[model samples]
Target: MNEDLTFLVLRQLQANPKQTQLQLSQAIGISVGRTNYVVRALIERGLLKAEHFRNSKNKSAYAYLLTPEGIDTKARITARFIQRKRAEYDALRAELDQLTAEAEAEGLLPQ
Candidate 1:
C-alpha cells in the first residue's frame, strides 16, 4: 500500500480498532478487498495485530491493533503526509494568486 493509504489505515484503526473492514473501507474510500489486502500486508509487516473478539459470536470479527512499531511508523508517515500536503497547498495558492492577477489585469475580474 502507498504511504497515504498506510497512514490512513493506521489512523482509522487507532481511532477505532473495532471497526469492520467494510467500515474501514468506506472511511478510506477504498474497496473492502483492497482494505483486506492492505490490512494483511500491515499484519505481515508486523505493524498491525489482528485479534479475534472472543466475546463476540461472530468468529470473523476482529480488532485491529497497532503494534508499537506501527505507532512509530504512523507518526513518521503522518509527518511526511502533512509536509507533502502543505507543499501542494502552497503551490495551489500560488497558482490561484497568479490566476487572479491575470484575471484582474485582463479586466475579467474586479480588483
Candidate 2:
C-alpha cells in the first residue's frame, strides 16, 4: 500500500480496533479488497495483531490491534503525513493568492 493509505489505515485501526474491514474501507475511502490486502500486509509486517472475536456472531470477525512497533510506526507516519500535507497546503495557498491577484488586476473582484 502507498504511504497515504498506510497512514490512514493505521490511524483508523488505532482509533477503533473493532471495526470490520468494510467499515475501515468505507472510512478510508478504499475498496474492501484493498483494505483486506492492506490489513494482511500490516499483519505480515508485524505491525498489527489480529485476534478472533469470540463473542461476535460472525466467525470471521477479528479485532486488529496495533503492536508496539505498529504504534511507533504510526507516530512516525503521522509526522510525515502532517509535514507533507502542510507543504501541499502552503503551495495551494500561494497558488490561490496568485489567482486572486490576477483576478483583482482583471477587475474581476473589488480591491
**Whole-model Cα lDDT per candidate?**
0.98, 0.96
* Clash pairs (backbone) in predicted model 1: none
The candidate 1 region of ten consecutive residues with least summed lDDT is 1-10
> What would the per-residue lDDT of candidate 1 be over residues 1-111, giving only the tens digit for each residue?
699999999999999999999999999999999999999999999999999998999999999999999999999999999999999999999999999999999999999
Q: Which regions of candidate 2 are displaced past 4 Å?
A: none
Return the top candidate by TM-score.
Answer: 1
Score residue 23 of candidate 1 by CA lDDT. Answer: 100
Candidate 1 Cα outliers beyond 4 Å, as residue runs: none
What CA RMSD would you report for each candidate?
A: 0.7, 0.8
Q: For residues 1-111, could you state the per-residue lDDT of candidate 2 as single tens digits?
A: 788999999999999999999999999998999999999999999999999998988989999999999999999999999999999999999999999999999999899
Sum up the clashes in candidate 2. Answer: 0
Error of 1 at 2 (Å): 1.0
lDDT of 2: 0.96
